[model samples]
Target: MNGLSLWDHLSVIRDPCQQWKIELKLADILFLTIAAVIGGAEGWEDIEDFGHDHLDWLRQHGDFENGVPVHDTIARVMGMLSATKLQKSFASWMQACYDVTEGEVIAVDGKTLRCSYDKGKRKGAIHMVSAFNAANQVVLGQVKTSEKSNEITVIPELLELLSIRGCLVTIDAMGCQRAIAKKVLDKGADYLLAVKGNQPSLEAAFNDYFRLDMFQQEDANGYSIQEVGHGRKETRLSLVMEDLSILGDLEYEWPALKTLGIVGSIREERSQPVKELDITVRYYISSAQLSPKEMLEATRSHWSIESQLHWRLDVGMREDDCRIRREQAGENMAAIRHMAFNALNSDTSFKAGIKRKQKRASRNTEYLSQVLSGLGLS
Candidate 1:
């Protein structure tokens, strides 16, 4: 929060509180700015600790709330802020922080705040869908959903708010819905949907037709094939057709179906090396007319959402261990963690995970200031 420059830039977009009181605006900004700097801050106590520790620097930077609102005041104001309005404003604020590169691969994934579940009350936990730019390693945006609703519903809602015109969206099987595909196309982006049992018939048909047309070269259109293996898994593949004919009588609207393929793979782990296993054939549909190399790149890049983003959150940022579950506190804190993740990743020269980056930031104020400046926060 030492840098008020980013907050000042966000203020220009729209009044943070045309509906709420001005005190609430100050409290919200102060809380979020601090949250961005220090992850895992929840409620008044955490913010108070942050303020107390950073008081001198915050005062020097004009980032401290006037008179340093007490913990109770901070808690009350946070409780009063409308969750919907705050989410919307925060989404807008994040859009201005990073530039979305053209043809960027935006990976969409969901994670539940495990501690948000109240077992005594039998209430469900908070679930959120996050859109991360795989190329830049930045979290573009996140949308919180009701505990009972699946991410399929929330993903589309989050997608509707983004501008991914030329980007290729990579999502897991949970997001492989026709409606979701249409929404992505409607937003002027392409999709690389993972085929799974959720769409049983579609998955079955794709597998069937792909196997039938494997070596026949039925379509005169462009086609290529490649095989790769690393670690413990090896994949043998063929991409044959380039038309909707691959979908064949499925009755799903696939206006963007341009490529079809069969991905066959075998796995042999260190513990089970003797028993080589051949998994079921996997299928995929892409909107982009990509070459074999591009398809492989897109497919491999999709896993970064898991390895780079989610793994970092769980291990590096300790997201799964968070126990804050009051109103929007869980959702808000998750967004702050993502913000920190992006900030740390953007500081590529740091050459370490979030925890180490934070330690470095905490130990070196000048370096931390430089990071904030890079984020347009200073």
Candidate 2:
């Protein structure tokens, strides 16, 4: 028996082509598009250029017997692909290469593909709800929706596809619903969800319970850290309380609810003629009975999905600047970028920023092969 190839895994993604009209293999096209994107190609024409210049490099992984498809052909095929299937294949590819460890923080969040919106077509920008592993700095999976509000519904669907057992899953207030909480718990994972106006009663209840002089309270558990930078001083105070008895009537409302927590942030300018101070407080709920330090760390780790994944896509991969507006094109292209990101992030042998890695993948075939090897493509 032979092991599966990269195309074998992507073969699960159904091709949207007629039997007789097929001039290019769907796998070959997908292979070219992904390699092109990994090499910093931002648009279909860029993909074509990358393919033309790196045909031999691409041939190292795929068969380009008919030569690279034209940019328009690449665009049309990608546009016509099933966005849902593309996402599934993307997730499957990630799962094939990575796994979340016990207690690893898997942050769930959403990002919008800014330039994907088109006024002429009245099509909204594409939004993606993603599961990111903070420890590994890799995206676990993602689901697409047209609007941020749609994340509430898509989050549970996304969770269903992940192997979240024993992992600590975290999401913002958008995913603070009871059903979402239950789903996370049922998936054999613990959860830390934000509490805000969306759950007005729960928010106010935690407020009333913690009003027992949190800063001076004897039983309150907290962790504090201070930072000074850019002519400014900032301090973060993270507090956690394991008492749920204060919930009173709503005590049993949340599933496996064990801890209620809060984060207080303060910032002050150092060089201002007239000094100013800023303070803000946030509330949270968790199923795990974590200490102040553990709770605080988990909360901070959830933001890695932004700093590591979302920020990289926007700034590093130039995802927000991409103009692939055709229906499903934006989403399918986003999936390719994610595959590129994971591949770049996983190969630690080349220690450099993502931009440098992208450049090397284009300018150096040996380094490109190493990155592709991370994705089981070379």
Candidate 3:
């Protein structure tokens, strides 16, 4: 197929013309979509400049049909698109471009577009919940939440939208609720949740039961422990305690509490050394009884959501500082940015930072076209 013909597949899902009364063909819309993201088109005007500058190359690559629409048309079409419809279409595209891996680690995290807040209107910024596949580095789906609601309320809805069978789901303290744990189990997936002040009773029970003195006692069987201090942080650890007898009197049924742990870390600066300690206890509810290595691997995989996904989107891609707050445009644009980031990350040859990759693609139309072609978005 030619570079732009892939849009025909997506057109079956949503017709831009019917939705927005735009006269452009699917190819034009697809080009603008890819260009807007990869070209660093902050808004409609940037997309227009990108299209106008790349017109000759676009025409050469494939049939232009009615030719590229002006920037105003691009803005109008994007503005007119129903956010819900766009999200659905994006989800469909994600499922098409990527396949869910068996035993995949799907991490759920929430982010707020800081610049998306409209202070004049006294409204909260767009806060979105994103589910990411840690292994494949692909976004599974995203849901927008009202400013007042926390991630706890939206996480279940996001999980309901995904097919997570055989996947390991990880979440922060906010999601460490019984209802959420039941939801994960009901979906045929295992869960590893971090304990914090929110579950004070559970935290204290786990801590008191696994206190340091308890490990030094004669009854510490089938339990191994290890500790590490690096970069001015101290981490305390214990492993593979098959028995939960110490936690017998807890009011809640923690059948999933196969292994419990506590981590404390301190930070030191040039001027002063600040001591900070956090007592975190977690429950590992899995279909497969994992060995110590397997459990540790799964627990460590949690940081991929931060290192591979969130960190990249914020620091690498500058997503947090984006100032596009028109209706759902900010969230919609952020989703597109994520799609672009995944596509770029999957391309081994394009190995620079996201900004550099985007600049290189924008400066070289052939490279940009090739990247989009691989994504089935040409």
Candidate 4:
């Protein structure tokens, strides 16, 4: 039933249960939990229910000698496991399953688990910063922080765990710091970071340069496209300038800085008046010398982390609806969801959206096997 077992990678995570008291094996628990999540299980109870329903199928991959553990046992074991170890395992499994090609865009962004907060403990909701492969639609790795502001710290840690060489790492305005840019360069990759009010001087410089209408110049690379959907028409203009002279020594602060980019979007709803049209302009700094088209594609690809990864976790997986706020259970459960996502998204046999695939997998063990095929289990 398997070739490249995810359990081989998961072996790095130490079981926290005492030897004498252990009823269910760690492999049994992890495999059951992962398979359940892949079948749309939202919480520990769902995971246990899935385990009982699919015990025979699960037994094919794992011993399940003691049968499926109770929901509380699953919760306790998952809570006791180290999140860091699980994350490293996830990263390793991803490397085994997906390869990052040269110039591939990897988007880094953060999402908050809204229901993870525990008022009894006076703890706030946790924010998870994830690195997603835009081209592959897979999650590479993630790091959890207590607050969104800590994403600045968590991002570097997450980057340290990935094989991002020869890739273009993109992030939102929150990741435009000099250290972050240098981290990307040091990792043997390039960065395309958004510039906003956080970096006041840089944002001001971009505003000043763009005001001159120099994007029309012959030396600058430019591209434009129009899209019609969702009852609106959108026109996107992308511009890239390789000349760093405009930065006036500010470029020295950013390591290997080579290009500046701007993407301006004008959208008007079909029912709205022309005067009511909406326009947005975003600025970016990149170490990669990308063309206008590449810049546009890379920037647009950055939002895939939000639209594909984060949105799917919340809606398809029902992550925010679960209130598992004890100890490290929430973080570890999130890791399982990422694993499930990588499996479901990487499966080519299913030609449907994530939710549809989940529903099919829940009803048909054959389709579930197809999903596990990505993890080297058929």
Off by over 4 Å in 3: 1-9, 12-21, 60-67, 70-72, 213-240, 245-288
Instruction: Give, for candidate 1, the lowest lDDT window spanning 10 residues.
Output: 1-10
Q: Give per-residue CA lDDT, model 1, range 129-230, as digits (tens).
A: 888888878777888886534788888888976778889998888888889989999989999888889988888777666543443455533233444445
Give candidate 3's error at residue 272 in angstroms.
9.5
> lDDT for each of the candidates?
0.67, 0.85, 0.67, 0.87
Output the lDDT of residue 259, model 3: 52
Candidate 3 residue lDDT tens string, 287-338: 3455655555666677787788888888767788777776656766877787
lDDT per residue (tens digit) for residues 1-378 in model 4: 233467678987788999899888887898888888889899889999999899889888878888999999999999898898998888887776677899999999998999998888899997889999998898999989999999899899999999999999999999999999999988999999999999999988888888525545666578889999999999888998888888887978889899899998889898777886587999999999999999999999999888888888887888888798778888898888898998988877868878888989988999898888677654
| lDDT of each residue in 1-378, candidate 2, tens digit only | 124444556888778988699988998899888888889999999999999998987777778988999999999999999988777766666665666678989999999989888889898888988899899898777889999999999999999878888999999999999999999999999999999999999888877766524755665677878899999888887888776777777769989999888887788888775455587788888999888888878988999998989888888888989889786788888888888998899889889888889999988888888888777777
The residue pairs in collision within model 3 are none
Looking at model 2, residue 364 earns an lDDT score of: 88
**TM-score between model 1 and native:** 0.83
Candidate 3 Cα deviation (angstroms), residue 123 = 2.0
Q: Evaluated with TM-score, which candidate comes out highest? A: 4
Q: Which ranking of candidates, highest TM-score first? A: 4, 2, 1, 3
Candidate 1: the clashing residue pairs are: none
**lDDT score, candidate 1:** 0.67
